[model samples]
Target: MPSSELFLIALATVLALPWLIWRLGRTDAWAPLVVVQILTGIALGPGLFGAAFPEIHRTVLNEEVIAMLGGVASWGVILFVWIAGTELDLSQAWRERRDSTVTAGLAMLGPLVLGGVVGMGLLWHAPGWMGPSASSWQFVAAIGMACSVTALPILILFMERLEILRKSLGQRVLRYASLDDLAIWGLLALILVDLERLGKQAAFLGLFFLATVILRRALPRLNPQDRWFLSLVWLALCALAADWAGLHYMVGAFLAGAVLEADWLDQQRLDRLREMLLLVMMPVFFLYTGLRTEWQLGGASVFAAAAALLLAGVGGKLLGLRLAGRILDWPPGQARLIGWLLQTKALIMIIFANILLDRAVISAETFTALLLMAAASTMLTIPMAQRAMKHFQDQSPEPSKLQSQR
Candidate 1:
């Protein structure tokens, strides 16, 4: 078959499976379409589909098909990260600095510490989790950050489902996640610091700072129509510079948006852009992500590792939030409710793990385990949050009413 024919088959398969499973299984409560798409990607990958239908896999997912998919996936993820960075309500976070700082700090610290300990244990028991180029500290830090991640976009979806997105609590949760998102990307840049490219990275930063100043002055003057075209050009340039600096292009994407004032672009436009990107481009990225999963450690071992990481990620998030709640004097059930919400980690964590794999900071087996942990963690979000909300309702009815009324 021609390469073009194969590419279309692969593309069709990627697009079709998600809708079919989502429609037939109706797994929205436990697994939303995004999560289902991710799972389907794994099922269709070399580890499963290729193993079961070797000839078919070879025919449809040939080298050309894979390369085409890779290009699409890369741009999809880069744009998605840029959108996330633009959505950071940092000014609002700073206005509510005390609450945001305390919560985000504790939330990040608990997972980092616990996940580091878990990484050390894994290193002792099975040393293959770290990549060939990774030092002990790099591996530990990457794993720790992975454990701490909260997928802000996915969290928004879940909150909307719970009918709390417009509520004050939902806004508060967004602030915390936004702050953590900033920290996560900052830490990633730190992790990606290559001694050989340190000069190039420094030069990139200096130039970027200068460019940001000019753009800040220029972007606001342009009509909204022109701003859209320039934004894409800026995004591409920033991503290229970041990649050249040995920081991942995704980091560059985030920085490109972060430096811009979100209000510069119309809020409706930003919302529409995000919706369209998720609706179209991000599924390709998810499928590509699934294709990268390796089962080299065997199914049982990989799953066991995933379970352990899930426990660390979820347990650490809850513990951290609980501690924060104690210090902040939150109401009896608020901590539990917020913890479950913040523990939702699907897209962002997968992106983080993919960067780790691309950098050779972690092996494919570790990436697969982290991906599983992310899916399971996200699946737990809605049901657990519902139960928490229910318990809170039962415990404090009138007060809840009064609060809601406020």
Candidate 2:
């Protein structure tokens, strides 16, 4: 069969299977459609579906077809990350600097510490977990950073689903997550620093700073339609330059968006664009991610590693938020609620692990484990957050009562 025909079949499968499962199984209460899509991606990978239907898998996802699908997936994820960076409400985070900083700091640090410990253990006892190209520190730091990531876009989706996106509590959570988002990207840049390409990386940063200044100034003068077009042009340019510098195109994609003000675009349009991207483009990226999964270390070992990472990621997030709550004098149960919500790691952590894999900073087994951990962590968020929110609402005084008291 022709590669083009196989590619079409593969694309159809990627787009259809996840929606069917999510819709039919009614998994939204515990697992969002995105989580279900991620799981489906894993299931469709060489680990499961490939194992079950080797002949069909080989025929449909041959090298040429996989490469074609990869191109589409790469752009989808890049645009998604760019949108995430653009939507970051840094101004609001600055307005709530003290509280946001403390919460975001602890939230990240706790996971970093715990996950680094886990990384150290993996290095010490199971050296196979580290990629051949990775130095000891690179492997450990990548794992720690992966644990600390909070997917700001995914968090926004969850908050919107929970009906708190425009509420004060949700706004506060966004502030914290936004701050962490900055830190997460910064740490990734640090991890990806290539000594060999030091000059090119430095040059890319300088050029990027200059380009950002020019673009920000120019964007305001253009009509909205032109502004959107120009932004894409900028995204492509930055992505190309970053890849040339060995910093990775996704990093470039993110930085391209981060400098822009959200108010520059129509808020509704931006939201709709994000929704459309999730509905259309991102599932391919999810499927591509699953295709990379390797279980050569044995299924038992992979699951065990994933479980350890999940515990570390979830436990550290809650502990950190609890400390922040005490210090900030948050109302009862608020910290726990916020913690569970913020612990949700789907897209960003997966992207982070992907970069590690791309850089050979982590083994494919480690990447697979991180992928599992991210999916499980995200799956836990909605149910656990609902329970905590219920307890919180029960303890708080009604708005009407407070108004009457006033």
Candidate 3:
């Protein structure tokens, strides 16, 4: 069969399979369509599908076809990351700085400490887990940071599904997640720091600041449509500069969106654009991610590693939240509920692991483990949160009853 025909078949399979499974299986209560898509991507990768049928897998996902899919996936994630950055509500986080900072800080710290221990164990056991170019500290730090990530975009979707996105509690969660999102990228930048490229990186930052000031000033004068177009132009330029500076394009992508005010864009349109991107572009990224997964260290080892990381990530998050609850004097059960919600690691963690892989900070086996951990952590979120939420609501009095008592 022609490569073009094979490419179409590959695309169709990726796009169709996940939706079919999500829609037919009705996994939304636990696994959202996005999670399903991620899992599907993993299933279609060499680890599962290729392992089962090597010839067919190779034919359909040929080198040419894979490259084509990669192009789509790259742009898709870039836009998605940009949107995530642009949507950050730093002003709100600033307003509730004390609560947000404490919660976010503890939440991130717990997972980092626990996951770092696991990373160390992996390093001690075998060199296979660490990438070729990675130092001991880099490997450990990347794993630790992976556990700390909260997919801000995925968290927002979950909140919206629970019908709490606009509520006070949801807003608080968003504030905490937003602060962590900022930290995740900052740490990634630190991890990617290159002594040889230090001068270029410094120059890039200087130029970026100057350009941001000019862009911010110009944005207010332009019409809304022009603002949107110009932002895309900015996104591409920032991504290019960051990559050239030895920072990843994703670092640039996030910075591109971070400098812009969310209010400058039409919120509804931005929301729709996000939806469109997820619907169309992100699945390709997921597929691309799946294709990179390898079981070179053996399936059992990868699964065991994933299980260990998941335990560390989830257990640490809960413990941290519980401590924060005690310090903040939060009502009983509220901490656990917030902890489960924040345990979301679907998109961002995978992206973080991908960068680690690209930089050779972690091996493919480790990436696969992190990917598995992310999927499982995300799958656990909705159900655990729902139960916690129900218990919380049951414990608290209704608004009308409180009013009557008053």
Candidate 4:
């Protein structure tokens, strides 16, 4: 009956509008879905209903919401990981091709190093928007690099829509994307462990990694049903451990993908799993990011800092990709695409930025700037990589020719 309580209910009801539209049979508009949901969350958050109807959010911010959101984020990530593992089928993918491997490696490397360097530089001339951050450049750079990197899930969706997943090159790109995701997420975990003290926070991940080593050896031969059950349990354990460590649930979710159910899970099961993620898991985590992001209205230096970081993030990935390709002796196109694909940043990095802000490791404006850079880089990389891939595919020889020669 309370006015604040009624406002909170109204906010939740408004957020339910998109799904209502979807259920009315219009799911093709994903871009609108994302925008509307995010905008709804923002309106409901402290900015509007929570401001005018301040009493509404007070009760809604209870422990239950946090716990539920935490669980959903955890499960969403696990489902994503499960799907990633399923995509590793290499029938079409050719790892023997020096060009593809070289391309993927370089592409993955470029933004990581570049972002790190730029993040470090911000320490020297503390931007007014960022205020004073307690964290060092190395830390900032690590988070920046992580944010600048791509999401395998989103990229895979693009590939599927293009009918590229059925192609040899597409399969290979997924392989490389898989590897890139592994390496970047791993780096993120290590950085987070260091941030929270490796001794305390790294223990579960280390254990999980070791378990992965064991599973990697056994999964190919395990009974299908057993593999499925064991993998789910492993996923659960990782989630619980991360929650216990006061780390983001995705740490466990990502590791679950990188390590468990890899060889055993197939398309059908993965599809079902993805349904759970899409329907129940990811929305809360992502929409919350949009809502909770603290926007500083007038911060020129923050804008400059954001721009600098974006350039560094993109440029670093490109640089790393080229260097990695050169060292590894990969072909030019493969190197280029890998670098581009790796530049697609998304939800994970934003999560890290929030953590940093929460811990007082960075200032409000700085955090918002980082998120801006992340969004811009993510938007830019996908189309860029697609174009690059088109050009590369055009230059490559047909498989039928090689088959005939053989």
lDDT of 3 by residue, 211-323 (tens): 99999999978999999999999999999999999899999999999998876777677678888988998899999999999999999999999999999999999999999
Regions of candidate 4 where Cα sits further than 4 Å from its true position: 1-70, 81-94, 97-101, 125-134, 194-206, 213-226, 242-249, 296-304, 318-341, 351-364, 381-406
Superior by TM-score: candidate 1 or candidate 3:
3
TM-score of 2: 0.96
Tens-place lDDT digits, model 1, residues 1-406: 8998888888887888898989898888888888887788778888888899999888888888899999999988888888788878887788889999999998988888888887887788687888988899999999889999999877887887897876778878888998998998898899889999999999999999999999999999999888888988999999999999999898999899888776677766776777787778888888889888898878888888888888888899899999999999988889999999998888899999999999999999899889889999998998899999986632322223211100
In model 2, the clashing pairs are: none
Q: CA lDDT of 288 in candidate 1?
A: 88
- Model 2, C-alpha of 346: deviation from truth (Å): 0.9
CA error at residue 341 for candidate 2, angstroms: 0.6
Q: How do all models score by TM-score? A: 0.95, 0.96, 0.96, 0.72
**What is the Å distance of residue 71 in model 1 from its true position?**
1.0
Candidate 4 or 2, higher TM-score: 2
lDDT of 4 by residue, 1-406 (tens): 5545544454466447656765575643333243344344444555455667766566665445645555555455556654564444333235454654565556655666666666667666754333343447536655455544666666665556655555655555566666556566666655555454556576766776788788788777878887787777877777678756755565666556655433356646666666566556566655455446554544566678778888877787777767776787666676677666566555545655666665455666666677677666666655677777776763443344211000
Best by lDDT: 3
Which of the two, 2 or 3, has more lDDT? 3
Q: Candidate 2 lDDT (Cα, whole model)?
A: 0.88
Where does candidate 1 stray beyond 4 Å?
Answer: 393-406
Sliding window of 10 residues with minimal summed lDDT for model 3:
397-406
